[model samples]
Target: MAEAVAAGRAASRGVPGRSASGRSRHARILAALVALSALVYAASSLLRLRAFQASTYDLVIFDQALRSYSRFGAPVAMVKGVHNGFGPDFSVLGDHFSPILAVLAPLYWLHDGPETLLVAQAVLFALAAVPVWRYAARRFGPVSAHLVAGAYALSWPIAEALAFDFHEVAFVPLLSALLVERYDAGRRVQAALAAAGLLMVKEDMGLLLVGFGFFLLARRGERRAGAAYAAAGIAATWASSRVLISLFGGDNDYYWAYGSLGDGMADAAVRVLTHPWILPGAVGSPPVKLLTMALLVVPLLLLPLRSPLALAALPLLAERMLADRFPNWWEPGYHYNAFIVAILVMAAVDGAYRLRGRRPPAALTRLRPVAALRRSRPVAALRRMRPWRALRRHLPAAALLAGAVVTVPFFAFGDLADPGLYRPDGRDRAAGAAVAAVPDGALVETANNLGPALSARTRVLLWDREPRGAPWVVADIGRHTFPFTTLEEQRHRVARLINEGYRPVFRQAGYIVLTRESAAPR
Candidate 1:
């Protein structure tokens, strides 16, 4: 087994056709591309914040959580608590099992603001390119490596994650790539470490780890390790979601998105086993689910379908698709897809390599007729065709790269081309002034759009329905903000506050700053 594995590795190295210096040069070029990607991602996200396009539901929630972490306090996110009607003492962990956000606390130590989280997320997304390039280089050539790396970096999943806000998934792409690359390279220890980190990212990440274990089990001499990993993943997911989350004051019932399947996980599993069509029924009824599944593979020209490594994505995909409560999970948007981007791209590289080497799947090798047909005249003639040869080798990567480039104009990255992305208008200035009117350290209720802007300075609660009686209020009445469906609803709320002794102290560009008359002035 060792000899055969070594021979395969040698063949992969030889196929790349690069000398030591050439390989080093390619590495340097790939590094430059990764740096450029990071810059672009950071600039785009930060610019959105500057333009008042960032929302408080998430960006501010994460910001508040990270702030507590930076200060060595509990992972409290008042924005989330206030929005959800939980009190200011609420811990973010009670909502989702992502302790990995604490790793980013050091970034807050340097900048101490929401912008720090956005920049950190961009860097994390860009860092995945390194592992992706290394893995692709081992399978394909240097050129294909670069193409795959670029494609992964610019993929729509990462773009959507960036467009939405900072999320725990920012750590997923890099860790998933590392796990696949290191495991394939026979460095089980590093791969295990990556898997461990993945478990920290979210409670559901263990399902992805379990899928990877199934992938490993299919490979020679890996069954023992695979079994151990699969068992660990199962244990970790159960402990984290059921025990850890509950221990942290979270209600797991809130995440029961599979009500349509059954009462709970056990019931759903039993139903899925007994009525297999139930899974398909759920996925098919919403035609958008099919479109999303297609969009995931279509960009890579369906190469992922050919590799068993794609199994790593199945659990997560099923988790999202089977959930009927959250429509966003079934759609091809937000940070939901970011978890599988690395797995899909790595599988595509593996698929292309298998095609280039003319390696038939193990199952196909057992079929006598299939083996005989390989030596047939028609097969030989087809192999000799230039287009057929190209399709089996370099063309796959080139076509994938071309497709990625072609599709960039339709995704969030395309916003970089619009001049408006760079310009912050009067609304932004007014929001800033409104944020400024609320003195530092004062308790302020802010609109969902302006929460992040003041979260760094003021103690902010979401200015949603039912005033929290905060001493200072900053809301945008000129346009509708989150939690308020109409502009009149926002205006009426502000008017009610005024009649109750809260007076508008600052108003500009439809932004209003109100302070309670009875409260001591700052």
Candidate 2:
């Protein structure tokens, strides 16, 4: 591994006119950009949590699960299970196969809080830049490599994921980039290891591996590995969804969000084949799905469309777009798109190389038209122009970096510039006091936004329409919060808690903390 890395560095330095010292300087600059991105990512998420803008639905659920893992317990997320009526014994694995989250358990030993997960996610997102830089630097020289890495670091997909909250998908970008870079570098062992890691991130990640298998099968001397990967991916997805999730007390059909197409995967596949015309309507019904598909490739100037490596992103995209049940699945937001960011960016890099008259590498050798186009009269005439000749090498990188800069103000990272983000006002202060009013080790039901604030110290449950009879309840009734539609509804629910042997011990800023008269800590 060390030898391979050294050789890759040497190859980067071999780019015309780049001395080892100059290459080192460029590496330093890219490293600094990555570090800055990490800082921004972590700060945005942490600030969102501190400002009381984060929700319990996922942040708290993941925090509770991570807390359980840190304590060497089953990854039971009471916040998620109780809210879903799945009971306290429910393991998150039953909901989504992300056992790889257990690897971060040790970090909880240092600081067992939701912030730990956010920071770790930021680091992982930024670390993906290393592989991205290596891959681009190998082909486009150090300057373009740095720009590509910067574009990836600040991409909208990653910014959206960071804005939403921590998720297992945080592992997707790093592992996906590694899989692409290592495979392209012909380090099959390392690439396979990365692919294996992705399988542990999510059950559906097998689709990515399957797509990569298709890419490998098309390459000479790679059919054996491709066949093995494809088989393993199929088996893993089947076992995890059909057996493991059920073993952990979850229903597989719970997330089968394609009922409009058919009953399940097989039925949907059969339906799509039998009625091919239905495909267009199924994928484009909402129109937003098409926008999302376009956004995924547009930032890279649609260059990924020219590379077969982009095939790896298709299955996951298809999985989301074809599902009519969940809007979030097809929406242009959240961690869903994070899964494909690295794949598309790397594919764009390959496409850029092919556009530069470089023969397609390995399996991509079949794309001879790309080279032919480079030699055509129009392209040749453009190349003969002094300006085009001078600027052509940097065009892709410059366009990518410019795209990121143009879009930054519209994404989560833009929140960094908002003074309100850094200023936690009265609501935040009241939330802090209300969370603190609840005693440690107590069973408490809390509002969706308050769940993470209290999760670290309390056995937190969702304070929803139905009362769970928790010993303590904390709610922010000043405004409508998640799982509740209106302030009137939230107030009514709190009033019912008061009717059921509970008294408000702390009330300020629309925040209320209640303790049951006869209830014990447990």
Candidate closest to the true structure, highest lDDT? 2
TM-score of 2: 0.90
Q: Give the alpha carbon lDDT tens digit for every residue of 1-522 in model 1.
A: 232233223323432567866755675676677778888899989998888788888888899899999999999987787667566778989899999999899888789889999988898898888778778877667777778888988898899899987899999998999898888777889999999999999998999989998888988888888888888888999999999887887787778898879999899899889988888888775889899899899998899998989988998898888878878888877789999999999898888777774666979977899878988899999989998876565676777787678768888888889888777678878887888788889888888888878878888788887867889988788998888999999999998888979888999999999998356422
The segments of candidate 2 whose C-alpha lies over 4 angstroms from its true place after superposition are 1-18, 218-221, 357-391, 520-522
Total clashes in model 1, counting residue pairs 3 or more apart in sequence or in different chains: 0
Off by over 4 Å in 1: 1-17, 357-393, 517-522
**In candidate 2, residue 178 scores what lDDT?**
93
**Lowest-scoring 10 consecutive residues by lDDT in candidate 1?**
1-10
TM-score of each: 0.88, 0.90
lDDT of 2 by residue, 356-464 (tens): 8664475554467876776789988987899887687888888888887887898777888999988888888899999999889889988888888877878888888
Error of 2 at 17 (Å): 8.2
Cα deviation in Å at residue 47, candidate 2?
0.9
lDDT of 1: 0.83
Question: lDDT (0-100) at residue 521 of candidate 2?
Answer: 36
